[model samples]
Target: MTSGWVFEEAAIVFVSILAGIIFFYISSPSVKHEKKQQLEEGTSLIINFVLFIWAGKIVLNIHIFVTDPLAVLAYPSDAHAFYMAVLLLLVNIVYKATRKQMYVGTVLSALVPIFLGSAFLYEFIEAVWNDNTMSWSHMGLLFILLILFLIRYEQIRPFTMTALIFTIWSLGQTILTFILPYTTLYGYMMSLWFLILVFTISLIALIYNKRKVT
Candidate 1:
């Protein structure tokens, strides 16, 4: 990868983490817990996410690392690594919460808002950095999502809210691809493919959750 590309990736990671931390701090007042508890939990969550990303990077580049231990840092992570890190973090959270018999909805509720903010910020930054005018529209949708989460955070189940957000985002992209047909991001069609997969999976999960509840 070019040095410029590496710098961009590193910038995205740095800003996303900073934005997440700021959002988490802002939402701390919304959390129903003591200051000490919030600090402890926040610290744990940060550590978990950092480790998750590190693990994902190692897993994806193990062969390269085995041959050239110092070369790993030169390789920038892509969307696959981000997705893997997210998957691992989610799995870890589910496992620990279930093992401890913690309230699932409550755990999710506490987690999702911070994520919503971070996701919005990351996308916004990406849009500006990449000079994608179409992406600003997508960023507007993310803004709506963040507002919705903030407004309904206490009233909805975490999993339900999360599913709803995923569905909305996926559906929005599906619509955007048609509405804005001229836009192209290096011909990767990232939004088009992501819309298909996310919409299908989220719809299925939403249906299954509803059926199970009923």
Candidate 2:
């Protein structure tokens, strides 16, 4: 791959991380006092995610890596790598929380905004910079989520925010898929059943959590 392609990929990843961190800092006032800790957590998560992506890329192209490590490094990661990164990120969170190294509620509050912010910015960059105007539909949906989270974050009970955001986002995207040519989770083209399933799962989690608290 050319240097330009590598630069763009790096730029997108950088923008995604920055957008998430910026959003986390702006809306999560509850943890404002723990800014350093939050920043460190976010940074760690982002770093791990990027590393997972690289790991995914290498594993997927193990033959090439075995033959020429530098060549494998030059290649951009794909949808599968993206999914691997997400899966590992989730696993990482669960492991930490189970071990009491992390708090679910606090991490989630920060995670939700970062996710939305990064998603919005990623789509924004895709739609504007990449001229994939079809992505604007995604941008619009994410913007609504961002607004909803920002508005209700202070009002919602802790720990429920992530479920709420996921439910709303999945529901919106599921609907958008019917009207638009396509929809993406990050840059990956996702299936309708998967989106609907995500909505259902998120809704279940939201209900279960709310009931538990009440």
Candidate that scores best on lDDT: 2
Native-to-model Cα distance after best TM-score fit, residue 188 in candidate 2, in Å: 3.1
Q: Where does model 1 exceed 4 Å of error?
A: 1-8, 24-46, 176-197, 208-214
lDDT of 2 by residue, 1-214 (tens): 4667977868896888687898788777755568667667767877898899889999989998998998888876777787778789989999999999987776676677888888888888888888998788888888888888878888996578888888988888998889988888667776787788779988999999988988
Candidate 1, run of 10 with poorest lDDT: 182-191
TM-score of 2: 0.89
Per-model lDDT: 0.66, 0.82
- Cα displacement (Å) at residue 195, model 2: 2.7
Query: What is candidate 1's lDDT per residue for 1-214, written digit by digit as tens?
Result: 5667877766775676667667756764454464335445544665787677667777899998888956775666655565677677768777878798444554555456555666667667768777767767667877888888778766766577778888987787687788886322221244476567878888887888888878
